[model samples]
Target chain A: QQPVQSPQAVILREGEDAVINCSSSKALYSVHWYRQKHGEAPVFLMILLKGGEQKGHDKISASFNEKKQQSSLYLTASQLSYSGTYFCGSRKTGANSKLTFGKGITLSVRP
Target chain B: EAGVVQSPRYKIIEKKQPVAFWCNPISGHNTLYWYLQNLGQGPELLIRYENEEAVDDSQLPKDRFSAERLKGVDSTLKIQPAELGDSAVYLCASSATGELFFGEGSRLTVL
Candidate 1:
């Protein structure tokens, strides 16, 4: 099953902050985040494993809550380059585990 | 190192025609995935290959869609008698662990 993402779209001014949330009905072993610019491939952002680790890079951060079966991506001091579609892929534990992705959220950062 | 490579970047064909897309994964990667993404939507997994074995392909339209990862290095996805609804971007990704490296994608337009 595909994960569900909140806030289908968001618009932000440069330096603003935004959060995209992903939730799954099943227990997740890991949550992976990626961002895709127009006409470009999706680039890996970060991965949060089951231990509830919060990872960040520069102004981008993410948190995964195993108990809640959810993950959130945080973008602080958003830049123009941040404008793109964000997708969250979740992998469930157990045999035959496969990664499933959410429908995605579009983030637009303006100057 | 070169990321996942896919070609051609764009293709157009009439309905009922056959179309094929190719992908070469990152060196030493053991997993390859094919996904379909509609405009304004996130990628949906069509198939996943662990080495040369297809571990998951339940989401693929078996009647008209087929895929193969030959020698566990390169992959090809083909659609026979393509329909208008098949017009979408085909993305190929490879992974050594779980974080994926994606190609630019092959955009298919069925007219």
Candidate 2:
């Protein structure tokens, strides 16, 4: 099943902060975050494994709540280069590497 | 390392026509996947291959769509008698373990 994302879209200015949330009805073994620019392929940003782990990439980071079956991506001090659609993929038990992505959240970072 | 590679960044076809997209996964990657993304939506997996064997294809529309990864390195997805609904971006991804890397994707426009 596809994961659900909140705040379908958001606009931010440089040095601002934004968060994208993803929730799944089923349990998740891992959660991954990706960003896609217009007309470009989605790029892997970070992956949060089970056990309520967290990972970071420069100013972007994510946290996974395994018990809640949810994840959230945090973009701090957003930059114009961060303008893109963010997608979260979840891997459920018994399904290794079979990711179901959430409807992307478009983030527009202005100058 | 070179990421997944896809050709014909864009294609235009009419209904009932045939179209094919190609992808070359990252060197030494053992898993490859194909996904379809409609405008303003997340990607949906179409097929996945381990080595040269397809491990999951339950989501692929075999009636009109076919995919193959002959050498376990490069792959191809073909759509015969393409329908208007096939107008979307076809994404190819590869993974070494858990995190997946995507290509630039091939966008199809059907008239």
Candidate 3:
């Protein structure tokens, strides 16, 4: 099933912080985050597996809460390069299936 | 050394015409995925191939779209009698174990 993302769009100034949340109705084994600039393919960001784990990039981090069936992405001290669409994908256990994605959140970072 | 490769970075065709996009996945990658992204929207999975076998193609519009990955190295997605709504970016991605690497994508504009 496709996951759900909150705050469809957000505008931030440089050095600001923002959070995007994703929730799935079904249990998820892992969640992956990606970002895509206009006219480009999505780029892999980080992955959070079950067991309430977290993973991150340079200034971006994400946490997965198995009990809540949710994950949240945190962008700290955002940069202009962070302006893009963000998507969260989840893979359920027992299926060995491909990741299902949520509607992306559009983030615009301004100077 | 290289990411997923896609050919014909941009294509323009009239409605009802035929178009095809090709992809070459990373070496030793076992999984290949095709996704479609409409303007201002997130990517939606079209199909997934494990080696040369398509394991998940439920989201594909089989009536107008068809895909094949014959040798487990390269894949092609074709659209016949394309419609105006089919104008979007076609992204090809590959994965070795879990993480995905994306191509620049082929942008198709149907007139």
Candidate 4:
């Protein structure tokens, strides 16, 4: 099942902060985040395992609540290049489980 | 290392036709995935493969959609008798250690 994301769209000025949320009805094994620019491939941001172990790049931070089946992405001091559509995908069961993604949140950072 | 590669960046066809998209995941990545992304939406899982075997294809519409991963390196997704509703972008992604790397994606426009 697909997750649910809030704030379908958000616009922020440079140096501002924004938060995007994702929650799934089914239990989650892991939550993954990605960002995609217009006409470009989706780039990996981070992944949080059920036990809270996280692996990802810098410039962005995220938290996963295994008990609640929810996750949040934090963009602090947003930069112009941070503008993009953010997607949250979650796996419900095992390593072989497919990732189901939410509708996505559109973020725009203006100078 | 090269990222996932997909062919036919764009395709336009009339309804009731057939289309196929190809993908080559990064070398050494044992897991591959095909996703369908609609305009202004996140990518949804169509199928998943592990090595040369299909591990998950529950979301795929078997009536008109079929996929295969040969040698666990290259994969193809085909759609027959396409409908206007099938107009969307097909994304190919690969993962190892739980992180996904996506390709440029193939955009299909069924007129």
Candidate 5:
């Protein structure tokens, strides 16, 4: 099943913080985060595996809870370049390389 | 290392026409994926290939869509008799472990 994302959209000022959440009805093996600007590809941010792990990259971070089948992406001190659609993906158990993604959260960062 | 490569960058065609998108995964990566993204939405998996073998294609519309990965290196996604609803961005991604590297994507505009 496809994952669900919250706060469909968010507006943030430069240097502000924002969080996007994703949840699934079924168990998940891993969660991945990606950012996509207009007219561009979705860039990989990071991936959090099962075992309730949390990961950070630069000012962006994400946490995955295998027990709850949920994940949250945190963008700390957001920058103008952070304006984009963020997607959270759940890795299927047998299909290790296949990912099921959410509807996506739109993040707009103002100057 | 270079990222996944896809072409043509964009395509505009009338309804019922045929179109195809090509991709080349990163060297030595055994996993490849094709995802369809509608405007302002997250990408949905269309197919996943593991070294020329399509392991997951349940989401692909078999009636009008087909994909192939030859030599486990390059892949192609084709749409025959395209429909207006088919307009979207087609993203190609590759994975070595869990983190995926995406290509610029091929945008399809069905008129």
Candidate 6:
């Protein structure tokens, strides 16, 4: 089943912060985050494993709560380049694991 | 290294016509996936291949949609007697472990 994302859209000024959350009904072994610019392919952001580790890149970070089957992406001091659609893909524990994605959240960072 | 490669970035066809899209995954990647993305939405998985084996294709519209990843490196997705609702972006991604690398998708417009 597909994951559910909160806040379908968000607009923020430069240097602002935003959070996107993804929740799955089933237990998740891993969560993957991606960002897609308009008319472009989705770019890999980061992956959080079941260990519940928090990962970061630049001003972006994410936390995974395996017990709750939820993940949250954090963008701090957002940049204009941060404008895009964000997606979270979840993988369940088992053989032949496949990534199921959420509908997505649009994030617009303005100058 | 080159990321996933997809051909014919844009295609237009009348309803009832057949359309096909192709993808070549990243070198040495054992997993390939096909996804469909509607405008303003996140990608939905159509099929997933582990090596040459299609481990998960439960989401694919089997009646009119078919896919193959022969030799485990290249893949093709086909839609026969396409309908207007089939217009969407087809995205191809590959992964060695689990973090996917995507290609610029093939956009299909069925009129």
Winner on lDDT between 2 and 4 is 2
What tens digits encode model 2's per-residue C-alpha lDDT throughout B21-90?
A: 9999999998999999999999999999998999989999999999999989999999999999999999
Q: What is the C-alpha lDDT profile of model 5 across B9-55, one tens digit per residue?
A: 99999999999999999999999999999887788899999898999
- Per-model chain B TM-scores are 0.99, 0.98, 0.98, 0.98, 0.98, 0.99
Which pairs of residues have clashing backbones in candidate 5? none
- Name the DockQ score for candidate 3: 0.63
Q: How close is candidate 4 to the true structure, as a TM-score?
A: 0.95
Error of 2 at B14 (Å): 1.7
Chain A accuracy of model 4 expressed as TM-score? 0.93
TM-score of each: 0.97, 0.97, 0.95, 0.95, 0.95, 0.96
Write the residue-wise lDDT of candidate 2 on A1-111 in tens digits.
Answer: 999999999998899999989999998888889999998889999888889988888999899998899899999999999999999999986435588899999999988
lDDT of 3 by residue, A5-25 (tens): 999999999999999999999
| Deviating ranges (above 4 Å) for candidate 6 | A94-96
What is the C-alpha lDDT profile of model 6 across B11-86, one tens digit per residue?
9999999999999999999999999999988899999999999988999999999999888889999999899999
Task: Return the TM-scores of chain A for each candidate in numbered order.
Answer: 0.95, 0.95, 0.96, 0.93, 0.95, 0.96
Question: Relative to the true structure, how large is the alpha-carbon lDDT of every model?
Answer: 0.93, 0.92, 0.91, 0.91, 0.90, 0.93
Give DockQ: model 4. Answer: 0.85
Native contacts recovered by candidate 1, as a share?
0.75
In candidate 2 chain A, what residue range of length 10 has the lowest lDDT sum?
A91-100
TM-score of chain B of 3: 0.98
Among all windows of 10 consecutive residues in model 1 chain B, the one with the lowest summed lDDT is: B93-102
Q: What are the per-model DockQ values? A: 0.68, 0.76, 0.63, 0.85, 0.75, 0.73
Instruction: For candidate 6, give the docking quality class from DockQ.
Output: medium
Across residues B26-85, which tens digit of lDDT does each residue of candidate 1 receive?
999998999999998889999999999999999999999999988889999999989999
